[model samples]
Every structure is written in C-alpha cells, then in structure tokens.
Target: MKNASPRWFTSSYSENGGVCVEVATNLAASHGTVPVRDSKTPTGPSLAVSAEAWTTFVAMTRH
Candidate 1:
C-alpha cells in the first residue's frame, strides 16, 4: 500500500455510534500485519501487531 491512506474497518457487531474501533485490512495483506486505531480519528496513529499476535489478542478479547 503506497501513495494512499489506510482503509479502516470496524467490527460488524458494532452498533450505530458505538464502540469506536477501526482496523486497517490493507496492512494485513501487504505485511501480514494488523493495524488498529480509533475510528473517530482516521489520520491518527495506529498499533500494528503480527498476524498470529492479532489472532491471539482477538481470542482473548472474545472470552
């Protein structure tokens, strides 16, 4: 991904005006990484975690 802004996606389970979380799917494909940031600020800094790390974090959050 170059010469462009990152695309962020919120969880499908999120309700209207709720749980402001956004993730960049593009990062996953190019670098095998997951970039996450606040949906409220699209241009803000994000945290990148490895694919395996991301999955493990999600599993922990789910439980």
Candidate 2:
C-alpha cells in the first residue's frame, strides 16, 4: 500500500519508563490491518498485523 498513512496512538496503560507500542487501528476498515510501531522509535519500521490477528491478540492480552 503506497499511500498507507496510519494515525498512531499509545495505550493509556503505558508507563513513563517502559517500552510500548503505538497502534493505528483507524486503518483497519480500509487496510484490513492494524499498523504497530515502537513508541520509542516512531521513524523505525512498523508491522502491519491482520485485523483478525490483531483482535485475537488484544483479546488475549485482556485476560
């Protein structure tokens, strides 16, 4: 996707000195995926996880 531009946001549970990831769930509707990146390196590489997989991961984390 050449024109993929995701608006990323960090989780509220993230700590001040802890490593965390930023996610752009907004692109899921059109891209069918959620973009994830390290909060410490915004310009670094990002991973695009499928919506189904992302949902599963989120569900697992809640428990």
User: Candidate 1, residues 1-63: lDDT per residue as tens digits?
Assistant: 454356778988887786588877676667788888888777778888787788888899999
Question: Clashes in model 1: which pairs?
Answer: none
For model 2, the superposed segments whose C-alpha errors exceed 4 Å read: 1-4
In terms of lDDT, the best-performing candidate is 2
* Model 1 lDDT at residue 50: 85
**Residue 58, model 2: Cα distance from true site in angstroms:** 0.4
Considering only N, C-alpha and C atoms within 3 Å, which residue pairs clash in candidate 2?
none
Steric overlap count per candidate? 0, 0
Q: What's the lDDT for residue 39 in model 1?
A: 81
Candidate 1 — which residues are off by over 4 angstroms?
A: 1-5
